[model samples]
Target: MCTYLHGPRQGGMYYFRRGIPAPLRSIIGKREFLISLGVKDREQAKRMIPQYTTETQAILDAAASHGPDTAPSPMRAAADFALWQNKQEAAEYQYQHSMEQEEAAIAREPLVSALEQKLKLSVDKLSPEEQAAKDIIDNLKFELKLSQEKRMPERAGGERPENSSNAKGQLKQSGAAGPVSSAQTSISAMYEGYATQPGLREATVRQFRSIINHLINFLGHDIANQVSSDDLIRWRQFLQKEAAVKGKPRSAQTINNSYLAAASVTFDYGFNERLIPKNPVALVGKVRAEKKIRLRSPDFTKAERKAILSASLSIDAGRRSAQLVGALRWVPWLCAYTGARVNEMTQLRREDITKIDDVWAVEITPVAGDVKTDEARLVPIHEHLIEQGFLEYIDACPEGPLFYDPDKSGVGLQRGQYKRVGMRLAEWVRGLGIGQVGDRSLQPNHAWRHTFKTICLEAGIEERAMDYMQGHASRGVGRTYGSNTLPMLQVQLAKFPRFELG
Candidate 1:
């Protein structure tokens, strides 16, 4: 007590003094802890001493509960929290055993006063019959008491405070319906805010949400400040090591995207909100994405294309919902000659395919829904496509989208949800063993784009013109003007070798 008092009698400051326990003195490598109270009066210092005493006792009691040795604060808090939980369970079973359902609904603090009046012991000292009050909230209350009593300083998770070796990290505010200690936004909360940005597509928003969820699951902590570069590193390793495409490790593209998503959510949002001091993932470099895709997905071969055409017309076209059959049937052919992506083919409206000038054309644009580029263009109706009854399919849907699942369609939903429409063809391809080239199978629907580029090059189509026709970003200054206009592109379509489907 005398050591805690220092300075001249005329003017002096009070300090906290606690000798390190013998067993932990060497490990702590400190003889004593001293912190200034910043006070000049003796009475205030006297009043503060009890709080420091109780906090130290709680820490030592936690150490004593586990064994006769002093341990660090996180370990001590863990042991104390465990003991508190056990005692609460015993007390609850003894006094409120019959109240389990109702008690569970009512938070523990809301019922604490009633429990205390009946049992009449401080929660820390567990009695035989009253031992059954092991609610987690009670543990939170005890932890909060220790933190407030000690006036603990800020530090990282699982880190010791500068003031005391036995001091744990700051206590978080209880999630219960009560007065919260402070305003702290969590990782999950940050994600909720990020999801609200306008102009983000449903698919793009979902990807960002998925990145945050991966990080949350990996670190097992939703608190933003607690996250560290180590956590990001482990998560990256997990995605690279555990994420797979057909039992093979994920491509560098997938891994790189995951890292990008995580950094955006954590550093971008967390830093802006001041929830974190700095972005924990800022220095975590992206995985070196492989330039060439290593996935086994391949383009449709000659024989495979022929078989698919046969199935669509013979078996599928005769089904009860012939309209759906038409979508599945012509979708591949539309992709074949036009070199358009699968979604573009499935999402086109009847109005989208109309005669422009003298040439009948397919208008690939955003009138139906969100286009990949949001930039509309015209692909002249290839003679092979029009010859395959495509005009008849458009006539069948004069007022609506040509391809859609009627079950999932609603007023708020986008045009046809062709995710399944695209998938069904991939499975059909897999069924025919068409997805494989050598030992590798083509990535379901995307292989068409690859096949289209290959065929265009083989057909001697102008190199730069292919980009514009396919909705790909154009290259070169002159290429930005595009190789030709809509009518001339019709000529290029005529050059494409036609495959008979009707």
Candidate 2:
């Protein structure tokens, strides 16, 4: 009877289930689509349903409307799903492998001692299964010995011993021996290991790799552990002396945040994984920004805010996609009131808009896109927005994302698409000739977050409430203890003064 859930199968895992529409089933070559949600918990499985439903429904609707010729072929869909499943499984395997490696390192001495004791004590009394396990362990020990002996001669510039007893095969299968030792692991290899950490987005992987590539290019050698503090410092100096982009020299902030931060984080991963002995990059002190750069305000000036808000209302719907126009119309206003990062507004789904006990609210959720804090929060719909027919706008919007069409988003990378929406909006704002300061066009989308904080302070809104509503973590550990309920937020939001856009 469930719409998209079928399970409590053998392992308590749930399956995503949906019947193919009768008309399109023949074209798609399936009666229904069923795939494991891979979650054992019912609530977690249910939370996953909307995304699956949206994606599956999108494909089905396309096939129905455009026919099989225009829509994705069944094979293409199957291939794409297979690729995603493989990536998910690979990520899981990588995490498990990493944990096993760490556990082996920590328990090595005790485990070997215990195994030796066990082998000395009961041999004939053991069950067949236990006896089999003991035999495998014995083979593993022999393989380890052979692997070590094979490497010792190679280190002494002698030929490896030819194994007669399947020692080489066992060593290879058991991963008791590898070509790349921990000390000699390349930076690229370390990145490959680091990048496999679960929940890392495509964009993040690209960024980290880009930064690490710069380091590799500078160093001339790629060994991970061989990187020293002086090497990092020289790279820092090189980056500082040269322009990373355009003709302008890389700023101190850029050097610190992007170059050093990336190196530190990636090397920390390498160090933790035993690929590297230590993180040398961490020893490099923070780069000091120019005084002017350090003092610059990220907030939009009053005139700039007025210009942006005014421009939002007047975007030519004729000139842009309906989704972009809708985003141009409302996202700025949402950010102006809520102090939300622009992607939060752009990723808004129609379902995220709802009334909480008579007060209308917008749910900023990670399910829509990446929330920086990775937690969902509700920002009460500003009275001014409601007055401007925001609810009416919501009523007219289709069932999914209010701003961008996922179909038009190219890769269906939700984070990337939503991020592009914010970027596009910033470009649109720049087109209006606002936020232009010297060579840099100020961060048009981010300005709202800064402006919103200032507005809250001026309106005497409590910092805690502002932090909660804006999806910012509380400053102190003690403040994280309690819940910030909808009613409480709504009451706090009422204190915000509505913008006089006239």
* Candidate 1 lDDT by residue in tens digits, 1-502: 4444443121245555566476643322234444455576677777766665655556545544454233334544332332222222222212211111211222232244456554555667756556665554467567655654453244344322112121222343222213321344577787777677665554445545656766765664566666665677777878788834445676555565444444554455554444554445533445665566455436777776677667666644544365467666788778777778777877776788888768998888877665667788887877866877778868877565677755444443332355445555656656766664344445545667777788888888876667778888654344565345777787776777776544
Off by over 4 Å in 2: 1-183, 197-203, 293-297, 411-415, 437-442
Clashing pairs in 2: none
Write model 2 residue lDDT over 249-291, tens digit each, in one string.
7767666655676676677566445454334553355566776
TM-score between model 1 and native = 0.58
Q: Relative to the true structure, how large is the alpha-carbon lDDT of every model? A: 0.57, 0.67
Best by TM-score: 2
User: Which model scores highest in lDDT?
Assistant: 2
The total of clashing pairs for model 1 equals: 18
RMSD of each: 22.1, 26.6
Q: Which lDDT value does model 1 have at 485?
A: 75
- Where model 1 places Cα greater than 4 Å from the true spot, the runs are 1-183, 196-199, 241-249, 272-275, 288-297, 317-320, 407-416, 436-441, 482-484, 500-502
